[model samples]
Target: MVNKPVLPLSPIPKKWEKPLRGTVKINFDAAVSKTKTGFGVIARDSEGFVIGGGYGFKNEEMTGDWAKLYAFEESLKIARLLNITKVTFETDCAKHQ
Candidate 1:
């Protein structure tokens, strides 16, 4: 049996925007609540298997937009580094389109 890998979405560095071509899609999403903020990313293969999933949070923020943006941007970078996985993103914050 082969061990599957997991990409923990935390400490998203400043660099994750650079694109890399591969056989995978990335999905990302962010949710903003009155008390806290949440953002996560999931990677799937062509067959739709959950290769890996991760999410980080920023608590006690007055503005959801900042948290959402930071989370989204960081998530993207994290996704790019992990190769051979389809990346997809989802977010409760719709304004971040």
Candidate 2:
């Protein structure tokens, strides 16, 4: 019998889509580490132009799920501050238990 080596599978790349006219899209992401957590949010218009963006880091530790939620909350705050009425949110965080 012969043994075969196994290779790790790679994730498929996804393309970003623009939002509809008269609306803005916000993409958010989070990073968690042993010492701190960080998040970023970017807002773009239908024309694919950057309207606003924000990023921040905290000195506390947290789980990936919590960090993702924090990123979402920050995105909402940015949208509100910009007086955006029609908005779409995007996140790459997968649900985990």
Candidate 3:
């Protein structure tokens, strides 16, 4: 097997943060259930415009590693639509990692 060089990703430029003023944060969580899977997203500005952003699906396809990857990819796509760059991503499956 040939070894391939792995290049690290450069950090997103700070310029992306210019449009955002004050402090803002968003949280994402996912709960996997047999009958249904649920994920929630909450966005809040320092001023407190708490937004309820979440979705739930009742299907077995919404479980396991592939499901998890899909969830993150979808979230990333949504984030790209907005001009938000600074984000905190937390996952409870840290140990399994």
Candidate 4:
């Protein structure tokens, strides 16, 4: 067997961004496994402080893409419930077709 050159590993640091003044940022994500789909949501203020957070589970199985879309919908519902008018929605899924 021939020896192969190893690549160096570098870590990239990620930071949470603050929303605009007087606005809240709502971030959401979803995960789909063999059995079910789960999602999480978080609301942050302009200072990057988390004001509210939520997690949900779906018993019915669905495709990963659908799950992501559903999670986004749920996040919006939560925001409405919270009476958050000015919000910046963030999601890992592609919003447009």
Candidate 5:
């Protein structure tokens, strides 16, 4: 009998979904590096049309969770600047231990 090594499985990719009618979906993400932390957000209407988007970075080290929270806060500012009333926020960052 031959022995085989076990391998880890990759996570399944998820497709982006459109928001409900008369509402906008804001997706945000954060990237943390040794030197800086970066974040980006995009707002799309129910039809998947981009209404607004923004990206920013800070020259400071931060944790992944903190970066994600910062990204969420920035996204809210953008939404307010755009006068968006109905919004749905989405983020890919999971809770870290």
Candidate 6:
């Protein structure tokens, strides 16, 4: 008899967190498909109001890691444009880490 190995499970958050006062929270994500890669970033204030956001697509093929990195970089650019000094960046790509 052969025993099957159990795969590790990732925890899902039940609730979302808001940033501290006078601060902003940025969330970024990326998706890779056979045709193209899509990336986006959104910035929200402490009250959960969206301050700014941007998204783009790459027609060229790319690895998942590269796509995720591009999403993070875009988030930083958006944050800078908003003039937000204090920020908390979050991403849902557990596999990237």
Q: What tens-digit string does per-residue lDDT give for candidate 5 at 8-91? A: 245557788999999999999998999899999999999999999899999999998889999999999999999999999999
Looking at candidate 2, what is the lDDT of residue 10?
Answer: 62
Which of the predicted structures, 1 or 6, would earn the higher lDDT when compared with the native? 6
Alpha-carbon TM-score of each model against the true structure? 0.51, 0.86, 0.47, 0.77, 0.86, 0.81
Per-residue accuracy of model 1 over 1-97 as CA lDDT, tens digit each: 9754443346344422323344444567666788877878776655555666688877765465677677768667766676544454555423423
Candidate 6 deviant stretches above 4 angstroms: 1-14
Model 1 TM-score, 2 decimals: 0.51
Q: Is candidate 5 or candidate 6 better by TM-score?
A: 5
- Write candidate 2's Cα lDDT for 1-97 as tens digits: 9754433246557788999999999999998899999999999999999999999999989998889989999999999999999999999735544
Score candidate 6 by lDDT: 0.87
Q: Compute the lDDT for candidate 5.
A: 0.91
Top candidate (TM-score): 5
Ranking by TM-score: 5, 2, 6, 4, 1, 3
Better of 2 and 3 by lDDT: 2
* Cα lDDT tens digits for candidate 3, 1-97: 9864443345333221211456445555566667666665555554557533455454654555555665565556555655556654433342122
TM-score of candidate 3 versus the correct structure, residues matched by position? 0.47
Clashing pairs in 5: none
> Across residues 1-97, which tens digit of lDDT does each residue of candidate 4 receive?
9854432245355566888999999998888788889999999989888888799898878887888888889889888888999999987523323
lDDT for each of the candidates? Answer: 0.61, 0.91, 0.51, 0.83, 0.91, 0.87
Task: List where candidate 3 sits over 4 angstroms from the true fold.
Answer: 1-23, 61-70, 91-97
Stretches of model 4 off by over 4 angstroms after superposition: 1-13, 93-97
Q: Candidate 4: RMSD over Cα atoms? A: 6.1
lDDT of 6 at 17: 90
Error of 6 at 51 (Å): 0.6
